[model samples]
Target: MTTAREVLDRCDALAACSDAPERLDRAHLTPALARAHGLVAGWMAEAGLRTWRDQAGNLCGRTEGREPGLPALLLGSHLDTVPDAGRYDGMLGVLLGIAVAQRLRDEVPTWPCALEVVGFTDEEGARFGTALMGSRALAGTWDDAWWDLRDASGTTVAQAARDFGLDPGLVGTAARRPQDLVAYLEAHIEQGPLLEAADRSLGVVTTIAGARRFLVEVVGEARHAGGTPYPRRRDALVGAAEAIVLVERTVRGSDAIATVGRIEVEPGAVNVIPGRAVFTVDLRAATDDARDAMRDTLLAGIAQVCAARGLGMRVTDLYEAPATPCADRLRDALRAGVVATGDAAPLDVWSRAGHDGMAVSAVTDVGMLFVRCHDGISHHPAEAVREVDVAAALDAFTAAVRTVGATAGSGATVRSGATVGSGA
Candidate 1:
């Protein structure tokens, strides 16, 4: 009974909880995130589910199945966003989940698996620069080194967690066992032009691209900008600029997707010769082998660029995720969902963009439903989706849930002895 209009309004409501008054800029472990959670938790509770904030900062809610304490078939998406992001990318999926909760609030005979939704805290990594922290933690893939990672304001993850009322020592307790999750279903915007060009309302995701991120540093001696002669000076910014050109030129017409999104230079004085330049690289490809091969060539090219510039070079890896293929069983359910929406056959597409499903795949099967956005615009202010398309997507998503739920043993939690969502 939840209309698409309500979902859009809710997204706008969440968008208002941003750090900047001028633009939408919500990030992880911030006051803005706390406010967003407070709003969403209420929505989840009103939809007939018990809600809680997981130790990893993910907002979660669930309702029991035919009996109490069944393993969960998960739904929902991240709530974080990039700077000045379009509201629908992650927000729509979450609001849709709440709609689904409303749709099934009074189940005549509750399905085998419990229904749970999670609004992940940090999928964009816009704040910490390391994406999928929330999903990875839920998948039991926590990295201790992340505690040392700092934000632009030099706030450590531990301090931020404490500031957000989370205990660092107990962060590990957020992990959910493999047996505790039956599956994870994420409905998201296509974030590309293909769906729109094809004139489709929805599509099925076959795989998610593998991505590797690195911070490459070019070091040079700092000297007086005016006094230092051209031959004597080693300008890091210049060196980094040259290397970044190589990054673009190398992947210009290739199947791989590469970007140098962020760069920073040392020496605050504008007149001072730059001593160090650190730039972030986000490299992704359809397959792991292709991605790695392209990375090897690209890094070698960067190293050569630094050597030619007579600069010290260091490459520090920020993150890496292997290409994740959708589970066939889950994919089938999604396909069936799309078919039920009057699409005789669903267009199967591989995602060029990264998703939290990549991290969650380790814990349970993962599948995605991609709704077409206006011209595939995302991460920008103009991102958009149609109400009719959303309504269709909702119908398909509900059918997919039933399709998977039907496979569960009669009155059983998991097919095996697995216990789904046994976490607090």
Candidate 2:
């Protein structure tokens, strides 16, 4: 059995392999990723799995099942991180998957299906500003246009791939056919306070929220801060502030969430009136329709603010991903796993944060297990998880794998008593 301390230790070790000195920041194709792969690959080999770097830069480890060539059940999560990231968001999932594989290799020598763990390379897209590049390749959703995407240093994706010793043109080799696998399972931090509030160690994810992001620029005439009359001022910052407030108000009553995570003001001085304000809007909901409704409302509200303030507004789509639901069978297996861990009824939570599962679902049925993070904090240095909860999660995940193996061919679907919520 794997101890939670061991897992936590590994997470700390990985956190140390960051490009940033004071914080964790491992982006795609950078030297940091090479170091990460070296360490993780060593661990994978120690777990008795053959390790390899795929064409799309994802690190993979595989071990055979009961039969020599059975289709593999994939257990994975992204290894990349946002700037100043927490220790347990994506790293915990990949490490837990490796731990689970190690347990299966040692104890269940003749498991029904092969087990594979993958640490996806670029799920965060912090470096290139385009998410899921790694999983999208695995899902056969790669687009040629992404090759031209440039980073802050103006390094194109193709150029970065070459620097990382990967052939950008051959990324297609990473694509896995739908028939090649059984299903995909990911265990990740809840990144929310719900599970901690419910007093549960782990929760079964019902759905991943559909998300859409836009970069909105509110442009207005620049005027002297003191000289301009209040009635004649066309303040872009004020217009943006009102639009931001409207975003919160409009989405409050619905099963949706809207956030203005980033904002930039031009002529950023105390004395200068801002001529332009650019901000990012990230909106998510349980369904695409609801998300679209929220988007429409937000845009309309922003338009009203812009018009009243004589500011010109422009929106550029940054990213969009549809909602993904867990397969009924897989959800049953996870619920049973939680039950075996002494939780009579597991909470069914909707994920507000985007995950690689949303991309992997394009190729196969996807399921997720979410363990609570302290105060639901993630993507920050203060993020934390309890050792007891991680230990419980390990027990539950391993049992879930066994349940999946036993029920793989039975085609049984269990209607759950899970408290399914539409909003994240």
Candidate 3:
């Protein structure tokens, strides 16, 4: 069986496969990502899984069950990451999937459910300006327009895929039919402070938060700073400053989380009055209704602010993704696994972050298990996980798969609960 220590060590090795020698910057479909895939495919093969890379550039490993034709339990997470990423964000989940497969390889031949693990090619959208590209393609939701999206280097996704030896025209071949899967399960880092604050090693994800993002622009006249009086000047920067504050004030006491992570000002000079200010608003909530309502309220309030300040404002909707909830049976299996590990009541969390599971849910039911990371820091170099917690997570993850396999045979339907070995 693959130990958690080995997995962490391998992560350190893969950390070297970056576009920049000084940082972990493995973007999708790049030469650096190809190196990463090579290393992971070897590990998958060693786990006794038949390995292959999909048309969309996702790496997959598969094995049969007691007999051929069993619905497969797909396990995995994205292999790609944000620039300067922490090794464990998406990387840890994919490695854990491999670890679980290695532990169960000898036992799966007698079980009814087949096993497959995937290391998704893109989840961070750091390359092609489209998130969940791999999972969406696998889920059969690929948007043809995404092919035109270009990276900072002006490489279109189609060109990048060609460079990576994948046929962009046949990317749809990577899609899987809904009937082909029992369900999709991913074990990922908590990426937040909840689990750490609770002093827990694992948590069950209730739902992935739905989000609406916009690029808001405030327009005002640019004038000489010394010549323009305070009353006569239309200051876009001041309007933006008020708008950012309003975003916080509007969502302050609510469950919704809002952030203005980026902003740009025109005529960015000390002597020139700003002509325009552009910023981003990312709002997320546990439910679609709540998120949409919060969005409506926030946007309307911002409009009022713009009107009162005598500034022209516009909002360009960047993206929107609805909430994806975990299937009941999968949640139960994960809960049983956690309970078996001595936590009778698994803490439930609403993911404030987005995940590939949201896209994968289009084709099959999706579930997630979150393992605690130190200080809940992610998308950075300092992200770390303990070997003990990983060992626990491995046990829980393997047991969870076993629980589902027992009930997901050719003719069997997955029931709410089942016993896996001595884990009840």
Candidate 4:
């Protein structure tokens, strides 16, 4: 049996493998990532699995089943962290997968399918501004342009891969064919307050929200604040403020979330009307069509604001990922796991935050189990998960895997890349 205390201690140990001494900041392919890789690989070997680093620098461990060449049942998550990250987040899922594999190894050394865990190198997009590099490669969706993506110090991803002793040309080898696996399972923190608000420790994820991001720039002529009268002034910042308000209002009217996470205004002088205003819009919804509709409405609203203020506006699409739904079979399995913990009815919530599960889902049916975190805080130092919740999560996660195995044996066909319900 894996105790929550033991798992929490492991989380603390992995937290030490960080670039910052006072905070957690492990980026992709850095020395700190290599150190973390060593630690996780050692633990995976201790759990009776053969461990190796994939072509894309994803750390993988595999334990064979009754037959040596069985399609693997993938389990794990990323090991990278955002700047000043908490101890858990992506790290907890990897540790929990290891513990589950260890427990199952003790119970049933050889099962129907191989159990594999992968600690993806990059999922935070902290260093290169592109998330799910590891999982995307495994899903056979590696974009060639990503090789040119640079870090803050101007190091290309290809160069960093070389520095990390990996060949960029071989990244495609990381991909697994759709028929090469049973299914993908990830256990992650809810990263929200829903479970805690509902007073539950665990929940099955219904879907992960799709996201479309944009870089919006509002351009206007700069003028002296004191010299330019209010009637004659055309401040880009003012126009941007109005546009932001419109964006908020438009998104609020729909079942979507919109945020202006970052903004910058030109003309350093306090006595100058801004010539340029730039900001980022992160828009998310349960479905692609809904998200696109909200985006169009928000853009039209921003254009109106700019037009009325005599400003020129430009919008650049940064990224777009469609919503992903959990498979019905896996959801049923997770529900059974929750019931095994005495929760007859588990809350099913939508994930606003993105995960590697999103990328992996492109190649296979993906399922996610969520454990409650304190106050829904994530990507910060204050993020915390309770010990009791983790214990229950461990129990539930292990049971979920068992249920998946049982379903596979019962001739319940689970086709790869198939979903239980329509994504909305």
Which residue pairs show collisions in model 2? 192-376
Better of 1 and 4 by lDDT: 4
TM-score of 4: 0.94
Q: Can you write out model 3's per-residue Cα lDDT over 124-237, one digit (the tens) per residue?
A: 998877799999999899999999999998989999999999999899899987667778899999999999999999999989999999999999889999999998888998
Give candidate 1's whole-model lDDT.
0.87
Native-to-model Cα distance after best TM-score fit, residue 105 in candidate 4, in Å:
1.1
TM-scores of all predicted structures: 0.84, 0.90, 0.94, 0.94
- Show model 1 residue runs off by greater than 4 Å: 215-250, 262-280, 299-316, 409-424
- Candidate 4: give the clashing pairs: none
Q: What clash pairs does model 1 have? A: 180-419, 180-420, 180-421
Model 1 vs. true fold: TM:
0.84
